[model samples]
Target: MYNPVRRNRNIGTENQGFGQNNRLQISTPYGTLKSFYERIEKYQKEVRIINDHEFLFIEEETRENCHHTCTFDDLESIIKQIPKEDYGDLKFIILRQPKRKEEILSPV
Candidate 1:
């Protein structure tokens, strides 16, 4: 489960917003790009853009699933919400998803 208050406490003051220091820091695990999108749709009910290159996604508690997809329109909508700014280059900090036991056992 995603606990906003607890997550904030763990991240400390460093993670108050998406791009406070000219960087986009995503605090969730990074699964396959496809899974990432699916989780976003299922867990995140709302997506808010903080700046031209920074966005915040609030997610719901969900069981980990590998099957999921995010649409192009959905991504576009998110990009459009960000307020325009002259923030130089953009940086992303995404957590990598852990491999499942089944994946490790499956043959290539």
Candidate 2:
């Protein structure tokens, strides 16, 4: 007997796995926006959440241009804010920083 209802339930489980793969590795300790804001503020650095998988940290802000960068310490700070149990399926965290204007303007 082929049960359509049973098949649908199995399909739902498969979909759940897909969603899990797309979530951020870091889980907020307080589970609130206010907590996230406060924790980030302690760094005294500007951050931009690019997506569930990535974030950008701005290191230098200037009148003409801004420098976005990340360091080992930055990653450590972020990891410290998350609970160990919340890491779920996250193998790595990628950080991207834009090149400085001077670097772009200057030749190799």
Q: Which candidate has the highest TM-score of all?
A: 2
- As for model 1, its CA RMSD to the true structure in angstroms is 20.1
Model 1 ranges off by over 4 Å:
1-65, 86-88, 91-97, 101-108
| Per-residue C-alpha lDDT of model 2 across residues 1-108, encoded as one tens digit per residue | 987667545455656555555643334565577532233221334444322434434333223453335564667678667865676445544333323443454423
lDDT of 1 by residue, 1-108 (tens): 877667455355655565656733333466555542334332444434444454444434434664324543465466566545543444432222323432454322
lDDT of 1 at 5: 65
Candidate 2 lands at a TM-score of 0.25
- Which residue pairs show collisions in model 2? none
Q: In model 2, where do residues sit more than 4 Å from their true spots?
A: 1-66, 97-108
Q: What is the C-alpha lDDT of each candidate?
A: 0.43, 0.46
Model 1: number of clashes?
Answer: 1
